[model samples]
Target: MLRYTLMRLGIFVGCLVVVWALVYSGVAPRGLGDSNGMWVVLLALLVSAPISFVVLRRERDRASERIVQRVDRMKSGLEASRNQEDAVVDGTTGAPGRTS
Candidate 1:
């Protein structure tokens, strides 16, 4: 997860630097707002999104799989704990003086 996040961030920053250079060099015209400000960031995000989608598919999938597995494990643990608690409350401990 962390690896994928860092990789995505790196790509975005790289794109941002490229955009900034283009704007600064007069190759790309500055638009509505200052290209050096939020405009550049938004442009970077737009450029990076597709680049990351195409280039980092494997990393993104791996991160998603890891997240799903972690959530599954957490959910199973919670269910088991709940079952144990329910059993105790319902008097199913199978010990002396405990009802089924």
Candidate 2:
């Protein structure tokens, strides 16, 4: 998970730097005054999304697989516990406990 997050952050930063350079060099339209930084950030996010999606495909799929396995493990454990409880109930009920 941490790896995935860091990868995404790296992509966003890369996009930001590239876009900032383009605007700084006058290749892209410059934002006026106050909104300049915000514009760069928004544009970075927009550009980073597709780039990250493509670049991080393997990591993303690995993370998804890990999450699914964890869920399956938890579900199996819960089912096993329920089955044990049911068995105990059936055993006790079938042969009632006797106190001497």
Top candidate on lDDT is 2
Lowest summed lDDT window (length 10), candidate 2: 91-100
lDDT of 1 by residue, 1-100 (tens): 9999999999999999998888778887676754457777888898999999999999999999999999999999999998788778667656555332
Q: Which stretches of candidate 1 lie over 4 Å from their true place?
A: 33-35, 92-100
Candidate 2 segments exceeding 4 Å error: 95-100
lDDT assessment of candidate 1: 0.86
| Per-residue lDDT over 2-53 for candidate 2, one digit per residue giving the tens place of the 0 to 100 score | 8999999999999999999987898887777789888888889999999999
TM-scores for every candidate against the unseen true structure: 0.84, 0.81
Backbone clashes in model 2: 0
Residue 9 C-alpha lDDT in model 2? 100
Taken over the whole model, the C-alpha lDDT of each candidate is 0.86, 0.90
